[model samples]
Target: MKGFFFFLCFISFSAFCLAQQAYPAAAPLPKKNISIFGRGLYPGDDATYELLKKSGFKTLLLSSFYIHADGDLYSGDSHLPIIHNGKWVGDSAYVVRVKNLKKHSSISRIEILLEGRWYGQPPNTFDFIRDWYDPSKTVPGIVTGIGEQSTLFNICKVLKEVLGADAFCIDDESVYDSPSIIAMGKIAAKLNMHMTLCPFTKYSYWGDILRASDEKVVDALYLQCYDGGARNDIKDWVTALKPQQPIYPIFMVRGSFGTCDSYKGSKSVDEIRAQLKGFKSDYPAMSGASIWQMDDVKKFVSMGCAVKNPASGTATDVAQFLKQLKTTFKREL
Candidate 1:
């Protein structure tokens, strides 16, 4: 009995040591590898990140960095530009918020998602889209013209030096063309910033971008499978794209309030676990997992249509769900 017990102890210790190296830890990480926790926070809702640290979610995908027709930049909810005229023009409050987020938080990595799609806008107006543009146009833009390219390069440099973000994730749902995506990746590399791609449904389009950005240009791919994208199957994606980069599958929460999507939503933590299992079974090579948010805690369990309603969900519920996810990955991998 004693000999067997000692054998079990030795195995346990070895496993623990292995996990320690790969588990979530603070920033300035030693020889950074693919992060296990890749979380997205809505442009204004940062409250959930405080609770999220408990689950070891260290990567913050701060979003909606809005670019303008004139190569200007803004955070989604905050209309004021953070960059302008090839400079970090962020106001005092904006600067403080970013500095404070890094200084007093567990986040070691922060990446802003570029959001520049106007679902229904005139063709003449520069959409701040993913294409080299005609500089003569009245509107300024990103990835277009020599001036626009310079402006984007400056924007990336400022994000690195002033705000201390590591990468830029393109939310180019309405990208003008493929090369523009690659151009953004090249510019990010020139500034020593990692390029991340966030795509839904159009795997072929994103797959091409991923190939162009991998290793030398891009570092991560965040694929969404919810709402209009609910039809996206992880297995199909893996077979089709065969991405060489780490894929951090992102799931839409806010499922309870129909805040994002209701179709195929996980109504409870149990459902989340099951869905995660299914995802893993399909794409076993996934580097990690990302939640679309931390801000949504059980806001409405008893509201909305019964079929579409996640009647008993909360933010803590989401955190607990992540805790389980971390444990499962640790054990399996």
Candidate 2:
């Protein structure tokens, strides 16, 4: 009986050690040159990848992946599961282009963004996490029900194996459940992918997740400095999570809903420069900055979204817009 008890104890200890080993301490934050959101990137053509290869960005965060009912995952506007029952069912072109882009581009890291709330739509991804995450069955560094049969785990696996993703960015706007996010961080760790927080508000909620999980897994914070997060101050976040993890502010350029200056977060190039200067002044160790997306860039050009501030530039093309944005980040911050 004593030997039996010792054997059980040994097994438990080994499991604990294996769990810790699964997610080692996160490495130091990389010095970000520029991280851009690719909302219109997946369906892009060879020209798009060519343009992106020369875009001078270090990270490309594919925006807004959703998990629909019954563990079906979707990206952008496709009505089918990109991953169903642990198999890739989406278009092969996307995977091929992404691989080629990474192989021949300045992009060193590619992250898939799991977002809540889409253009005033329901928060499907967060809802899925809420319903599917079995907190009562969790262990020290991992969660139960996030295994082979789990949709969450399957999606993470496909994103890592198929998409070659380096990390998962959590944009939990509505659901502030720390346990669910911590569970996701652990799952990401299990797949050897890091988890990043994209929080516009609810600093305490994010703080709770960071404190609960290993810092290496939940390594970076991308603060949205646009739209609803227009009033967000960078100093507060820097103060809260500096030296441990790096903080990068994300900005939305002037172009969305076919209006430039009308959008509250939409800023002219000069405005962005000034804002970046202000952020740098507040925190000198600020990691870097990111642009919201590429779809808006096209909308601004095609919809004749005239320059609100003529002094900014006379350029009205997509190339000009991207160039100006890349130049602003390179020169300002």
Candidate 3:
């Protein structure tokens, strides 16, 4: 009886040791948030939304409106449009459209893209005068100057009040003067909205611009990573600017400038993918990546942008790729 009791105790101790060894303590997993930007130029149609859902995207950066040539604001245009279920709704009807989308779709977060004149110029007053003066006459021209500051301020106020946007993206950096950028940041903070500054190149005074803006108000820094030029530029920029700030890397799948230049030698999806894969492998500190202008991707593929084994299917192909990334990385979308 004594021998049997001793044997049972030994067995129990061995089982406990094995259990502790098999189930070693592990570290907590990091949270990953995937966001995509939708250009009003292309508008998020049913197909786009379907792709987003399949790709496991939880947030959308939407282009909401733009300043028109007539010193007036227009909603639905090449730059800004109100799209619902793939249909174009008028600009004045953005609030209703966004509400409906939230109610019907799986979109939880909305970031509005606020665009103005290319170089911080006020809307063209001559165009307004011509349009109002004569119905059948083309507007000649107008000087765009500092009046843009007031116009931008007014536009920001109206957008926050009407659209109830959670965040805003400053699409044009030419207009991002220190004072104007800081003022916009203040307005965003008052309205409880986050701000994203899209810096296309390292030469742009983004660091100074961001510094002028309220640090608490700015949420993320969006770096346009398109060509090899951008790759080197962004890596250096991030290294210099990684001071408790989130950096969002934006990749352009198709565009006029960088896409043509970078992919000229190798004209295949595999080639493009290889370039991106190398970039990610080299620079693993990127917060997240978003592809530029979805329509451009479609256009490129249609225009024979693929290499040897052409990437087939619609934007769905890109979505699947993103989903696979999430699974492989063990990251949340």
Estimate the TM-score of every prediction: 0.71, 0.85, 0.61
How do all the candidates rank in terms of TM-score, highest first? 2, 1, 3
Clashing pairs for model 2 are: 26-216
lDDT of 1: 0.58
Best by TM-score: 2
lDDT (tens digit, per residue) of candidate 1 on 1-333: 999999999999999998644221213221222233232332333445455445555577766677666766776556677777767776665455555664554556777777656567532112444443334544334444434256556777777777777777776565546666776776665666677877776777888877766464576777776645566667777788787766666665544334434445533444455666788787776556665554333332223322454443332345565565455544433
lDDT of each: 0.58, 0.77, 0.50
Collision count for each candidate, in order: 11, 1, 1
Order of models, best lDDT first:
2, 1, 3
Local distance difference test, candidate 2: 0.77
Sliding window of 10 residues with minimal summed lDDT for model 2:
135-144
For residue 304, model 3's alpha carbon misses the true position, in angstroms, by: 7.1
Candidate 3, residue 94: CA error in Å? 6.0
lDDT of 2 at 6: 100
Candidates' RMSD to native: 11.4, 6.4, 15.7
Residues 1-333, candidate 2: write the lDDT tens digits.
Answer: 999999999999999988768563322244765888889776677777777777877788887688776576787645557877557887789888887766767777888898876567875888778767784554333333676556678788888888888888999888788888888887887887798999998878898888888777877889999888998889988676553777888888777656765476777777888999999999887767888887887777776665554643344987777778888888876
